[model samples]
Each structure stands twice: as C-alpha cells, then as structure tokens.
Target: PARRPPPSARRLMAEAGVAAAAIPPSGPGGQIRKEDVVRALEARPPAPAPATAPAPVAPAPQALRAVPEGDRERVVPMTPLRKTVARRLVEAQHTAAILTTFNEVDMTRVLALREQHGERFLARHGVKLGFMSFFVKASVEALRAFPAVNGEIRGESVVYRDRYDIGVAVGGGKGLVVPVVRDADARSFAEIEEAIAGLAKKAKDNRITMEDLAGGTFTISNGGIYGSLLSTPILNPPQSGILGLHKIERRPVVEDGDRIVVRPMMYLALSYDHRLVDGREAVSFLVRVKECIEDPERMLLEV
Candidate 1:
C-alpha cells in the first residue's frame, strides 16, 4: 500500500530544497488529514543510520593569502526614487542652455533701510521686513526695464509677461520649495513680506498648496540664509532668470568721494537663459536692481 506523506513533510521539503506533493486519503472524496500523515511518516522513518564512521583527523593551520591594495571595494544599490532623480538631473544637463554670472553689491543701504524700518514695519503689519521684499520689488522693476530677461522660448516664439509673478525660493525644515508670489509687481513691501512669510511657513510645515507653487515669471534664491557668500543659482525650469542672494559681510568699500568705509557687502548672481536674454540686457537688468536697492529713494521715483 502506498502511504501518505506526513503534515510536516512540506516544512521538511521546503527546508531541503525539494517540492512536497499533497496526497489525498482513502475516502471517496479524498482528503489529507494531519493525524494520518503524521502517524505514517513518524512510524516509517527508521532508515539505517550511516554505520558509525570514524572522525577525520585535524590538519595543520594554513596561512591566509594577501589581498592586493588596488582592489576597488563596496557597491550599493540605488532606490527607485533616487534613480529617477538622477536621470532627470542628467537629462536637464543635455537639453538646457546653462550659464552663470556673479556680481557683488553693498547691502549697507538695504540693510540700513530694513534696520531702520523693521520693528515698526512688523509691529504695524504683523510680519517682519526681510531682504526678499527689496529684491522682489527691485526685480519687478528691472523686469519692466528688460522684459526679455523674464521671457521664455515657447514653440519658436518668445513669450514675455507684462506683470511679475516672482517665485520665492524658500527653505522647508529640510528640503527646498519655490512658492510663487503672484502679481508681485502690484504688491507693496509689507504685502510682499506677508505673502512670502506665509508661504515660507507653509512650506516648512509641508502645507504649501499647488496654488502656492505655480505660475512664476522669475525666481529669487536667497542662499544667504545658509551663509553662502556666492553661488550661481540654477534657473527654475520655465523661468528664464534666477537671482541668487548671498551672505553680507562687513567689507571696506569706497563710498561717495572715495570714502573707504566698512559697509555690509554681499555677492549677488543673476543667472539667465542666454538664448532668450542677451548678455548686455541680463547684466544691465541686474545692475538696475542693484541701483534701486542702493538708493531707496530710487524705488519711490520711477527710474
């Protein structure tokens, strides 16, 4: 009589790298039960033990082989998200036209203005006055002067925006997010601060909505927060230009009439799409913004 395998046979087979077949029992509609299979396998398992073999004698220890110094070591596997990020970053390098330009500015005037007005500005408006407001205001004015710097290539046609929608490059608690301040041109300094502060807070909390992140004509990245003295900021995709703000340090700069004084100086960068914006226009536009920030009255006057 052919016997059935034990219930534990599947477990033993799985461990030994062998397949286990389920055997049906003697009933009309046959079924394998645990009690029958277990009894059969347990009772039949008296196979002869290998006739007591002699223990092998121990050999002497062998010396270890030396490894060459030039062997390249460890390799780690990349996750799916990491692979995708790497591919997209590489793809941008091949297709996009990238260029970086740098300039230094005396932030003495801008900082002074902020210091003089910050407390009162915050007290009245419920938001602190930050450097971004000055840059946003100045950039909007500069874009008006040089519209091409704020333009993008669309199907062989250049599209320029009449109004400004500035993307504020904000820091989350960890990563970075660019939240757009729509119609930045029409807003006042206080309004800009309020909007930027709200977006920045929301971004940190990961509560920034899609509406807060879309539609921007230009971008401003403030690397100064991380103490970066100078850096060429990348253009935020569709936007043609990005202004980088750097840390301010006290440097002896020549003021009016060659008066060398230790003033708060900062490095600024305007990286724009050269294909859409000419060198003269890009540099000139940055210079105009610098001029506006340097002379606060210039912001009030249409210059």
Candidate 2:
C-alpha cells in the first residue's frame, strides 16, 4: 500500500495545478514531498487547447527518412546543478539592470611573455604558464582601481569588498561550475595557476564541493578555449561584474603614424550590474584590464 501525501504536499500540488497521481513519491515510506510536487510541476506538459478547426498541415518530404516522430526526438531531464544554473541566470537577468561593455586588447606582449617563459615557469611551478594568470592579475588590478565593479548591491546599500576572491568559470562534467580562487590578490602567478588547475580538475571529475563554489567578489569566464569569437557573459548573482574573454585572432589594425599592422587581438567584455556600477566605471574597468594585458608590466609594477 502506498502512503498518501501530507496535507501540506497536497496543498502545494493543488496550487501548482498538478494531479496527485502525476507526482512520484521520493520521501520515506513512499510519501510525496513538496520537492516531488515541484519536480512534477516542472516536468508537466502544457494543457491542451480547446477544440477548434484543424489547420492544414504540409506532408513530410519522402526523401527525409520514414522514422517515427518519437524516434526523431529525445527527452532528457536536467541535472540538479544545471537546474540551479538556469534558475540563477534567469534571476540575475530579472533582478539586475544588466549591461555589457566591450573592448579589444592586443595580446602581443602577453603572448610573447608566455612564449619566452613557458618552459622555465612550468619547470619551476609544475603548472604551465597560461593566459588566465595574466588575466586574473590584471583583473585584480582593475577591480582595485574600480571598487564598485567588485562590490555587490545589498538592498538600499552597495557593499564593497577589500579582498579579491575571483571565480574562474570552468566546464565541469555536470555542467559549467565556477570555483573560487580565494584571496587572489595575495597569490603569486604560480599559486594562481596551480589553484585554477586544481579547481579545473575537480570540476572535470565532478568532485567539486559547495565550499569551492562559494563566495566570490568577481568572476572571469574564458570562452576563447571553446573557440567563441565573441559573447556577452551574464553576471553571477550577488557579484557586480563578470569578465568574458574571447578568442585571439590576428587582425589588421592601424598603429602609430597610420601604419597598418597585424596584431593578435582578443575581445574583452565586462558585464556589470548597472544598479551598482555606472557606465563610466564599467568602461574604465574594462579599459584598465585591456591596458594591463597590453602592457603586462603595469600589473607587475602595481600600476
């Protein structure tokens, strides 16, 4: 005999317009919990429309296989992590006055620096010198210069953080997960590389814990690795800003004296909460990042 859902669960199912038989019980002793009701609501199909005149439909081309309609489509359930991501993304868009600002950076100096020190840095640090370290360092400098970008909006107030806990977005086995690099401002290049590597491995193995995904003052998402040419990254909630990095390509540009030259350029986008950060500050923050990447010495000099 199956146990019936409690009165609270029944009320929830009623409010959600789902039938009791439609929800599966996962609670102890075959009881339907509120969570089960919610899942059912999420999975429920739309109600059929009232009967009306049937519209003419076109026949499928004979060349197109004769496979059944069901065989051509598949339905898969969203993982818990993916569901949370979807919810948070929608929440961020709805709650915040989100805006994106774009800028292009010449990666010539940074690439040269990497090529010059790749072997030695790897030999000493046991982690290859990657572009992320440079970006993280540059972002730290930029965030420090524009504190509002690193701050969050708490009802009626803007909270600024002195510590830099940067979240590096990585694709995990489950989905995309952002694991924080705690106190990034104090970490050396080697330490930052090691931290990102460890977090990436954990994400790939699906062994990341909630603590690793906890509080971050800012987030950096590198879509360049996946060959994304350009994209506007959405803000991670509670954080005022997110930085999106795109692919580096050789493009012709005008230099000093109007000389056209080929340069490796990467597009940078800063998506910020307009409620907390003004347009001037957001643009300045992105420009600051561009300057640090282009020069590569300003970050070292604390400029």
Candidate 3:
C-alpha cells in the first residue's frame, strides 16, 4: 500500500499549483510532509497544459522544456556581494537621471608610443604599461576641465569634489569590484598602473576590503579586453560619471577630410547623471578624454 500525504500537505500542494504525484515523500513512514511539498514547488518546472486543452494553445518551438532528472537546472543562492551590487545598480537607475554619450578615439599615437616604450616601462616599473593608465590620466584631465561631471547631488546641494579618486572596475572571483586609485591627479602613470594591478590582484584573491572600495569621484570600466566593440555603461551611484572603454579595431578614416586610411580606433562611452551634468558638459568631457588619448603627449605635457 502506498502512503498518502497528509491532508494539510495535499491542500498546500494544491494551493501552490503543484501536482500531488510530482511531490516526493520525506516524512516518517514515507508520508509526504509540508516541507516536501514546498521543496517540490520550488523545484517544479512549469506545468504542461491538459491533453483535452485546445491544440492552438501549444507551446512555441523555442519554449523551454523540462530536461532529464540528471540534467535538471540548479538554483544557487546569490552571494552577499552580488546581492549588494544588484541593489546598488537598481538604486542608481532609479535615483539618477542617467545619460550616456559616445565618442571614438584614434589610437595611432598612443599605440605607437606604447609599442616604443612599453618594454622599457615594464622593465623599470615591473608592470605592463596598459591602456588603462592612459585613460586614467586622460580622465583626470577631463574631470579637472569639467568639474560638474565630477560633482554629485547630495540632498539639495551639488557636492563638487576637489580630489580625484578614480575607481577602476576589475573582475573579481565573486563578481565585478571597483577599487579606487586615490589622488589620481597626483599619481604618475606608472603609479596608477601599479595601483590598478595590486587592486586587481586583491580582487582576484577575494581579499578586497570595504575600505578599498569606499569612495570615488569617478569610475572607469574597460570592456576592451573582453572583445566588446562598444557598449553603453551604466552609472555607479553617488558618482556623477563613468567612462567605458571598448575594443580597438582597425577602421577606415579620412585624413584631413580627404585621404582614407585604416587606423586602430576605440569607442568611448561616458555615462553621467543628467541631474548634475548637462549634455554639453558630458560631450565636452568625452571629447577632452579623446583629445588626450589621440594625442598622448598632451597627458605628459599636462596641456
């Protein structure tokens, strides 16, 4: 004789739209308990329609189907850091009027400069001279030019920060983490690269601390390494602006508005809080960054 689930468990399964036959019993003497019914509800796939239902109600060819028991989908809980990131991202979207502006930078000079001095720079600094340092320096210069982009809205007052602490987004073992490069305006290019490297190591090792991510006047996210051609990045909360760097690809461009030549170019995206930074300021800020990158000497000359 097969043991039946208790009346309460059966009622709960019915109320939850779960079939009694689908639930496995785990109670004493093979009786189905309420917990067993709840587990079945959580693990259940969408119910199929009755055989007598209309033929037109059939699921589409692309609709999901249940797999074998061994190939069932696994449900894993989100970590605390992941949960926090989710909440903050939603909050940023809701609380700020966000806008993203795009621009493209010709990487001719920067790439040439890197090709020439990259080996020497790495030998001296013990770290590779990556595009991020250039972008960081460029961002510092841009922020200095457009103070409004570095400013945030606090209550009814616009809080403009004098210090430039740039946040570099890095992929961590748990998820993405943004670590700050403190006093970026004062740091040398090599120093900025070193700070990013160290922070990235800490993040990969899952040793990144709250203090490491405490505050930032601005953020930079480079999706170039992952082969993204272009993407509009979302704003990180409390900060007025974020710069997104994408993959550099060879594209034909007119030189002096006549000669077409192929050159390596990268698209840049500046996502800012429209509530604080106007469209003109946002566009100009991105343009300033492009100017610095296209003419790498401008960053060195501090022009």
Candidate 4:
C-alpha cells in the first residue's frame, strides 16, 4: 500500500533533517504532500530576538486593535484508506530498521529500444510499450539476484518469497493505492505493460478491489510522473524493500576513455528494512536493477 504522504514528501522531510511526525499535513485526508513541505519551510518561525535587545516601541492604537477573524479555518476528517496508510507507516517506522541507498541509471538504451520496437509491439499487443514494464522486469531480475530484498520478517524468522508479486503505486480518486501484478517474474514485457495499464484504469476509476491491493512481495513507486526529481521511498509493511523512480533529465557525464556526453538519466532509490536486508544486499539489488534497465536485453535473455 502507498503511504499517507507521497514518498517524495517523506524523503524531503528526512533530507531536511526534520522529524516526520512533527510536520502538519495539509493534503487531502490530512496527508503531508510536497506543497505541505514547502509551506512548512516557508512558515517556520524565525529565531527569537536576543534577551539583551531593547523591548521596542508599542504598536499604534489602530494596529494594537484586535483584527477580526477571517474565514481561513477548515477541517476534514481522515478517510479510512488514509487512516490505514498513516497507521501502517508509523508501525513500519517503529518496527523496521529502515535505511535507503540511491543510484542513477542512464536510460539511453531503454529509450532507444522502445523507440525501435514500440510500433511493432503496439500493433501486436494493442498497447504502447512503456517504461514501467522495463522497470518491473528489471526489478524481478534484481529480486531474483538478491532474495533478501524480496523477503519479509515474520516473528523471529525471515520469509523468502519464491514468487514475485510487485505492487505498482497508482493515484486513485480516493488517494494513492497499490495494485499487485501477481507472478511478475514470469510475465513478458508486453504482459507486464498490459497488466499495469488495466490496474491503473481500475485505480483511476475507483473500481479496484481489496484483492487487487493485497499480497505484494515488493513495490515500485514512480514519483517521476509527478515531476519529483529524487526521493527515498518508505517500505510497505512486512515487505523488506521499495524502489523509487524519479524524473529523467539530460545531464552530461564522463564515459569510457574520458569521453563526455549528455544522456537521459533517472535516479533510483531503494529503501529496505535493514532488519531483514543488509546494506550490501540493498546496494547490490539497486545495482542489479540499474544494470537490467541499462541493458534491456539482459532481462529478455534472462542473463
């Protein structure tokens, strides 16, 4: 399930070194959103005047008069879905030893591959080839390479999931929701795209059921669609890891033989429950994803 706040907002709070719970959420259903973060920063109280400073002159009589109350106050109760998101996030913070690591991937190859094969693929599957399938397949490969990232802690034991059930975060009318793609590891790229398309439709239409939202081993949240440049994702309860995708921008970088060129780059963040997955495992998992996305053929070849 998606957290009460978008993962990007939570990441912003962490990056600013602020307490997550202390900030007030102005988002729908009292969830902290990106705008709320900006508001909090802008509204922060300035440092108090020094004790030695003179107690300045009093305000004019007209300025001293109490200002009439304006129509600025409003309250909305939390929806059940939002309440569930809040409770689970707090529980995750208290229970899991959460940590996040980041990396950047060059999307040059993936973009080229899509452009070359997209037309044929669309004609055959009746769906346009998109980036989600590449990432889903890449994630499945990465999860296979590092099972700990897919595993969850149960009581005193770590449960390793044999099958890949990935939750793709989508925005719905109510709030953000995650619908699972069952057995993702076994699905082809076209299949993955179609599944995501169908699920996203159901989500936007508010027709997704509880069964669609349940039982996921891992999750992928793409804040890039909403223009987030980078973010550290929060873990969904019981799951050990979640991946965050950010906006792709063209940036210059040095390649082999001291050659510099501009390439489409996207930042990736992996947040894992350190209680179950180690730093090495988390880092390696992210690297594996980067490799697969950088060379889409690796997924097709099962390399």
Order of the predicted models by lDDT, top scorer first = 2, 3, 4, 1
Q: Per-residue lDDT tens digits of candidate 2, residues 96-204? A: 9999999999999999999999999999999999999999999999999999999998878889999999999999899899999999999999999999999999999
TM-score of 1: 0.70
Q: Can you list the residue pairs that collide in candidate 3? A: none
Give per-residue CA lDDT, model 4, range 1-303, as digits (tens): 224888767776776676657677766777877556645654565445578967797666874766568737676666546755776688789989999999999999999999999999999999999999999999999999999999988878889999999999999877898899999988988899999999999989978776688789999999999999999888998799999999999999999979999999999999999888999999999999999999889788888
Task: Tell me the lDDT of model 2 at 63.
Answer: 88
Per-candidate TM-score against the hidden true structure: 0.70, 0.79, 0.78, 0.77
Query: Backbone clash tally for model 1?
Result: 0
Candidate 3 per-residue C-alpha lDDT over 1-303 given as tens digits, one digit per residue, 9 for 90 to 100: 457787757777776777766777767777888657755654555555568955586654766765557875786766656755776798799999988999999999989988999999999999999999999999999999999998989889999999999999999998898999999999999999999999999999999876688678999999998999998888888899999999999999999879999999999999999999999999999999999999989888988
Against the true structure, whose lDDT is highest? 2
Each prediction's whole-model lDDT (CA) = 0.76, 0.90, 0.88, 0.87
Q: How many backbone clashes does candidate 2 have?
A: 0
Give, for candidate 3, the lowest lDDT window spanning 10 residues. Answer: 40-49
In model 4, state the lDDT of residue 21: 74
Model 3 ranges with Cα > 4 A deviation: 1-70
RMSD of each: 19.4, 8.2, 13.7, 12.5
